[model samples]
Target chain A: MYAKRIITTMFLVTALVITLPKGVFANGHDLESLKNTVEQLKTQLDKVQIQLKAQEEKTAKKKDIRDLKQKIEQSSIRPVEFEINDSIVHLAGYSSVTFADNDGAGDRFNQVQFSPIFHYQYKDLMMLESELEFDIGLDGSTTVALEYLTLDLFLSDYLTVIAGKFLSPVGQFRQNLHPGWINKLPSAPPGFGHDGATPISDVGLQLRGALPPLGNVRTNYSFYVANGPELEAITEDGEVELEGIIAEGFTRDADGTRVYGGRIGVLPIPELEIGISGVVGKTEVTVLDGAAFGDEPSRRYRVWGADFAWKYKGMGLRGEYVRSTIGEVTASVAPAGAHWRSWYLQGAYQFLPTKWEGVVRYTDFDSPHASEDQKQWAAGVNYLFSSNVIAKFAYEFNEGRVGKSSNDDTALLQMSFGF
Target chain B: MKNYIHIKTALHAGVLILAFFLATAGAQAEKHPNEEGDSAQGAKLWAQTCSRCHNMRNPKEFRDELWVAIVTHMRVRAGLTGQDTRNILAFLQQSNSVARKSSFTKSSTTSESKGIAGIGVSSQDVLARGKTVFEETCVACHGDDGKGVVPGVPDFIDGNGVLSQSNEVLFNHIVNGFESPGSTLAMPPKGGNEDLSNKDIKDVIEYLNATFGS
Candidate 1:
């Protein structure tokens, strides 16, 4: 038993020595000293055991101590079952209920919106992020949909390869600052949100990254090839023609053709970014009326825009202009063959003395070949309780140069929160 | 022919002027307000100390410049030092600074060093070596999760733990040992690992701060 104890002690000591860094030994003879110390400890332990046996005449304390030591030893020697800590999951989202009163049109509180974002990181190389939006109104109408699902693969310091459905990398508002918590205004500028002139997202692969700073300027860029927007037959207003943005986010290809989109931006300074973006796709459309009623061969749809943002101190100013066009679809019925334009400019200021930020914006949309364009002017203020919670109030004036409005103006009150 | 030369020269000068303006503007926006303090420490401080009274925030809650101004205002209220304030700024910028990209010009390129302007990776070697020291020495007392196994050992997983002590305090105590009037059991210098160099200790400290920080 004594020999066996010596063997086991030497083995454990050797294992410990091998595991530690080579530099951890204080002296050349440290190993020898350790062996001698262990031997002396053994002798002293035996002496103490005898003394305890004579004094207490019981092994309760000794057994308890031995059991504890044994447990520690066992735990220490077992293999570490390390959980795969390569990923960090963050759950961030927002909920908002907005009340709007449209001019001339009866006003009512719309839906309660709950959008939840799941951002997951797999080590340093991959990211899987998605957001789901749910809208439930007091009238019992409900809508639920996946807003976007993006998979990003970090290829290099300067570039990332991305796949899956992602926000159109074309403009400032669509790809960034579109989240409810991040958006300063309660509603997107006229002609810019979900029903905007340009498509907001597509399904495809993309490459994006930052470039080395140029002197004092910094630049970032993105390029994508995706299942592009297709011309859809618009049935509204008793119209039957391939129209724009009707099937904008369709993931499946209609004519075995893909669309190309890209954006390039440069920071003229830390406070400002100027960028240009464009997308091109092809689709077939057959207008049953309005001029060319026959099946039109596949035609190319093109969109291009410029956006800029300048922010300093507590003031932010931004604007964007987008133009979309289609090849000879129709002159009367399918106006997409003509030209359409959308543009907006906004300014926001934070009165630091108070937690209130005031904003003013003007947006205009010109339909294809329309004699009159639609325009809106808006102003609002946000009282921030914290970074994640805010209360907002806004009013907007809308007018059509040629058309009629069920609501000529609107006002809104909103409260939004996120975690 | 002479007219063509004049036109070419004028256009070249215009391009140069635009480039110069862009560079100058970029510098204005990319200015690092302060270069002191470490971001890891700032994250820990923000997570543990500031969140004590208020809730934690996502980095995207404010702009980078706004964050700097807010930190400056709160420094006096919170009684934080200059280093602490700067570290917090760095943390906020790295965590939440909105990335800016160059506008599209070229189609694509396969090249080295094409990356995000403000993003960077830390030295892997130092972190790797530091992790070795931690496993060999630190795990014995401050167990795998930096939770204390003994009565006197302090927990390092939570905020304000032994590891979160100011760098100065950690340096002094770790270099020496826990020596105070009311101390029950004192930790040994270098956690009783006599062979550890000052660099080894520093590396381990950095590893702990980076890995377990907020």
Candidate 2:
């Protein structure tokens, strides 16, 4: 009976062990699987963080690039430009090259000229202006000349006081229209040139200004007191007579006389200007046939001029008349009174929207010497490369005394630039 | 002897006249104060005065500082008033800004190619405003007859003239400034009026077409 009971206990224990082991092993396997999943999830989170940081860095770089582009765009619209200060120095002027063929003289590249204008300004009150002309002469020599120099004081809105050598205020040609780039043709009017009827320059004190508008009319004036001009006389064939008037700025007044002159201009319309000019002085003959003279009595000198300019659309019309007279002096080598008279009428027209322009001028010059008198008609056409640059071709028909150089017809081609 | 007497009398007269002018100059200055320059008035003066002696210089030819010197020199040469000088300077400075390349787009290109007007405004008020602006600003160089008064300025009445271009081109030119072919001078942006609005430009373009177009 004992042997049978022991065997039953053993069987019961074995059955219990088998059933509990299966259930417990299953739960342990599930916990191990959950631990593996947590490890994989942590690795994935690390990778995602790295990728997010990279994306954030790239976005920042893109924003930086956008800002740089915006800055470039803003800078392009209005650039930082130059600033002007007080006490400015400026240089401006003109240059010209010409080819000419006269009736008696052969054609050649005869002219090469450069004129430099210097300006030094102190605010709006004062300015020092000077012009220097350099020219290549026929003798292959270079000539340098001071064209004009003046210290301009702006006294008021309407007036300026100018001191030093200044262009003559007698007429418009010498003062306003003599620049190569400004003049439509290559040559000056017959009597408007040097040793001609008009005065070239003067060393003096000048008061110049424009007046306030009177209704529809505007006016301008220039008055000056200067060292008077000197007279030149020549002795030929037992005759002594006045040769020419040296109206340039003289450093010394040998005659101890002063000249007074002025010009008054009236503008009836904005496009039209009329002017009158006059001068009064005493002049003495200082040179006789290119020789010095002494003890010459002073002679009366007078000059009067009238000028008009009208512009309508692209057409311009202008005219000027001048007469210079010297009274007789019994004590002088050339005692006979002499007079130089001159007149010119000019017209210019521009073809709009084109670079071509046409100009015509007629001039009559009469002097005491028959050989010096001239009547001329000048016609020209200009092709403007710019407003300040021009190429001109002109022809002159001249009539003077027989067998005189003044009677020679001429043709000219020129290139001029104003800078 | 009589000539010497005449010279003395003329000298005295000149001195008296100079004194009178000196006395009156201060009064004139006081009467005309140093006011801000008017670009419109300057345009008129430039057209009237510069062409009287020389050809009109393009405003773009010189920088601001250079223009100041040149104009000052011209003031002495031409005997211009101080006010006139300031006004011309104002006009030159306003016009001296450099031109910019246009920012054109494909959409705008397509519309322009199709000849479709963009941002159309047909109001009479806008047209009248355009007319007034043109008269006040452009009449100095371009006459009331739509023909240019100055050399190298385009004639608006010509069928194949500047108006023949597309509206986009015209708009770009008017906004940024333009230099015509073979022309030395360039038309300044907004006709040198910086105060002009984009709408004003468009209206003027329309007016140009309606009035001066072939």
Among the numbered candidates, top TM-score falls to 2
lDDT of 2 by residue, A1-419 (tens): 34654464455445544654465446777656645654565466556666877888777577798999999988755454335256778999999999999987878898999999999987777889999999998899999989899998887777888889999998899999988999989998988988899998988888887877777687889999889689999998999999999998988887887888989999898889999999998889999989988789999999999999888777888989999999998877899999999999999998765779999999999999999899999999999988989999999999998788899999999999999
Per-residue lDDT tens digits for candidate 1, residues A304-397, read: 9999877543467789898877677443345456556789998877664356778898989876534336788889998767656878889888
DockQ winner: 2
Q: Show where candidate 2 strays beyond 4 Å.
A: A1-84, B1-24, B27-35, B100-120
Candidate 2 lDDT for residue A60: 59
TM-score of chain A taken by itself, candidate 2: 0.84
Against the native complex, each candidate's DockQ, computed on alpha carbons, is 0.03, 0.41
For residue A17, give model 2's deviation from the true position in Å: 37
Interface C-alpha RMSD after superposing true interface residues, each candidate, one decimal:
17.3, 3.3
Tell me the tens digit of each residue's lDDT in model 1 across B1-214: 6886686467545644643444343232212234454565565445333432222365556555455545643342233434455667766665553222223111123111221111123368878987898876666445567764322356677775565664445655665556333222345555545456666766777777777754
Assess the local accuracy of residue B3 in candidate 1 as a C-alpha lDDT between 0 and 100.
85
Give the Cα error of residue B55 in candidate 1, in Å: 16
